[model samples]
Target: MNAINITSTEILSDSWYTLKKISFEITANDGTKSTQEREAYDRGNGATILLYNRSNKTVVLTRQFRMPTFINGNETGYLIESCAGLLDKDNAEDCIKKETEEETGFRIDKVQKVFEAYMSPGSVTEIVYFFTAEYTNEMKVHEGGGLIEENEHIEVLELPFGKAIDMITTGEIKDGKTIMLLQHALINKLMG
Candidate 1:
C-alpha cells in the first residue's frame, strides 16, 4: 500500500525540536476506496539506544530526569536506561557509538545491529535505532553524561540481568528503547 501524500501542513512549534500539523490521504492497495485527508506530524529521527555488555554478566544503565514524566506525578522521574541519544546525524551506528562513549565512558567495538522501530508512532515520530556492543570495565576512561550546562544529571547504574528485569516491572526502567534492548539481549542469550 502506498503511503498518503501530504496535501497541506502547518508549523505548530519550532525550537530545538519541532511539531507540525500535516494533512494527507491514503489510496488503498486493493483499489477499494481512497481515504479522506488526515493530519499527523513529521517529527524527524530523534531517539536511539546503546546496549553495553560488561563481560561479567551485566549491563550498564543510567538514571536521569525526564521533565514530562516528572510533571505527571512521577516525582523525580529518574529512569534507568541504556546509553541513548537522538538520531540527528547521517550515520545511526556512529551516532550511537559516540553517545555510548560520551554517556557511559565505555569505548566499545563489534557493534551489532538489532532492531529499528518507532518510539511513539501514534503521536510522536520518534524512530529509534537499537544496538548492542561488547565491552569491559576497563574501557571506561571518563565519566559519562550530558554537559552540565545542558542541565543533565545522570547516574550510571551497572546492574545484573535479573535486576534489570525487576527494574522494568517496577517502572524504574521507563524508557521504551532501553527496555527493548534489555529484552532483546535477554531473549537471545547475547549478554554474558
Candidate 2:
C-alpha cells in the first residue's frame, strides 16, 4: 500500500458535499505506473448512536428519506437507522450528542464509543463514529424529527432490540452503520 504514489487528483464534480474525482498513480509493489481515474467523495466524518432501553429491551432509531437510495432502487428511501449526522464542525462525540437529540428526542448523558468504520472505501471518504447509549423515559426533552429547514423529515422509531436485529435479516434495515450498532448491542448483551 505504501508503495503506491498518487501522482494527481482531479475533481470532476462538487455539487454536493460529496465530491467526485480521479487520480493517477504509480505502484512500486508491482513496478507498474498507470493513469487511473476514480471517484472520491469526502463529506467529512460522521457519528451514529444507538440508544437502548435496558429495562424495556428496546432501541431508538430514525427513519428518513435518502435521495441516493431512492434513485438507486428503493422507491421510498425511508431508511430505518440509528441517530446520525455529519460532524460538520464539532467533534464526533459532540456531533452525535446533538444529532441524537435532534433526531431521536433523547438526551444522552454518556455515549460509549464502540467503533469506527468507512462507509465506502472505494469512493466515499467518510468515516462513521459508532456509539451506544442507554435511554430512559426521563431523557425525553423534546419531540425530534430532524431539522425541517434542512429537508430532513425523519421519523423516530423505538422497537424491541430483538426486533431491530431481526430487521437486518428481514431486509428492513439496510444502513451499514445501523446494522453494526444493533449487532454490537445484541452480541454484548446490552439489554437488561
Candidate 3:
C-alpha cells in the first residue's frame, strides 16, 4: 500500500457546498515519492432509495432538472432518478426516509439498506448509502414535488418496474444512483 500525506487544502468555493483543492504526496511501495493535487467537491454524504411494489410491479421515482447534466450535453436537463438527499444532520436511514416522503410522497417505514458506494470517487467526496423499500398506494401521504424552500421542483413518477428497467437501455434513465438501485431490484427479484 502506498502512504499518502495531505500537504495542503485550499477552499475554492463555499457558496453551496464546499469545493477544495487538495495537495498531497504519496510514497509508493518502491520508495518513490510524488506530489499531486486534485479538487474535490464535498457535498457531504447522501442516501438514495428505490421504492418498489411487488404486487403492482411498479417503482417510485423522481424527475428533476440538473444543471450539471444540462451543461454536460443532456439537452433536456431533466433526469429521472431515485429519491435521494444529503444526510445533513441525520443518519443514512433517517435521511432516506425523509427524502422518500419529501421527494416521492411515499412514507416508508422500513427500508433495507442494500449497499453504499462512492458514486464519483475521482472528483467528489460523497459516499451514498443505497436502500430499497416496499411501497403501496396507501403509503402516499401527499403530492410530492420536493421542498419549495429548497428550490427543488421534483416530479414524482410511478413507473412500471419493467419500463424503468428498459429506460436504462434506452437512455431515458441515466442517473447513476437510480440505475444502480433499479438493477438491484431486478437482480433481487424485488418486484416478485
Candidate 4:
C-alpha cells in the first residue's frame, strides 16, 4: 500500500530552479492519517567525479564561489569541490565526463561509478551520481575554468591525497560531495 498521496503542488519559484510546495496526505502504520505540506527544490540530477592519480597520490579539485554558502556562513563563499555538473539531457556518465574536461581540464576516457546519493533528502529533489577516474598530466588538454557564458569562474587545484584528507578535519574541505568522495578514496585505497 502506498503511504503517501500527493494532493496538490504549487509552484513557489521558477526564477532559477524550480521550487514547489507540495501538499500530501500520509497514512501511518497505526491507521492514522495526517495532512502535510513540504517545499521541494528540483534542480534536476547531477554527477560528480574525483580525478585521482595513483602514481602521484594526488587528486584534482575545483574552487568556486557559491552564493548559498556565502549567505549561510561561508566567509569567502568559495567552496572546494569535485568536478560536477547537471545531467541536462545527457546520461550520468556523459555528463560527468564533460564536466571533468570543462572543470578540471582532464579529458578522461574511463570512469568508475562509485555510488549514487541524495545529498539532502528533506527538500531537494536531486540525486548525485558519484564517479572516480584515474588521470595523468598528458590527459590535460586545456586550462579548465568552466563555461564563460555561464559565468563560472572555477579555480583548479591538484593536491596530495593525504593533504586533501587532512583538509576534511581542518575544515578546509566542507562540501558534502567532495568529502564523501575523499572518504571513499581513503576507505578504498584509491591513492595507494
Which residue runs of candidate 2 sit more than 4 Å off their true CA positions? none
* Best candidate according to lDDT: 4
Tell me the whole-model lDDT of each prediction, alpha carbons only.
0.74, 0.88, 0.96, 0.97
- Scored against the true structure, residue 95 in model 3 reaches a CA lDDT of 98
lDDT of 1: 0.74
Query: What number of clashing residue pairs does each candidate have, in the order they appear?
Result: 0, 0, 0, 0
Kindly list the per-residue Cα lDDT of model 4 for residues 1-192, writing each as its tens digit.
639999999999999999999999999988799999999999999999999999999999999999999999999999999999999999999999999998888899999999999999999999999999999999999999999989999999999999999999999999999999999999999988
Residue 122 of candidate 3: its Cα lDDT? 98
Please provide, for model 1 over 1-65, each residue's C-alpha lDDT reduced to its tens digit, 9 standing for 90 to 100. 56676777788778756777777667677755454543345556643554556567778888888
After TM-score superposition, the amount by which residue 181's alpha carbon in candidate 3 deviates from its true location, in angstroms, is 0.6
The TM-score, computed over Cα atoms with residue i paired to residue i, of candidate 2 is 0.94
RMSD vs true structure, all candidates: 2.4, 1.4, 0.6, 0.8
TM-score of 1: 0.86
Query: What are the models' TM-scores?
Result: 0.86, 0.94, 0.98, 0.98
Worst 10 residues of 1 by lDDT: 32-41
Residue 155, model 4: lDDT of 99
Q: Model 3 over residues 1-192: C-alpha lDDT tens digits?
A: 999999999999999899999999999999999999999999999999999999999998999999999999999999999999999999999999999999988888999999999999999999999999999999999999999999999999999999999999999999999999999998888987
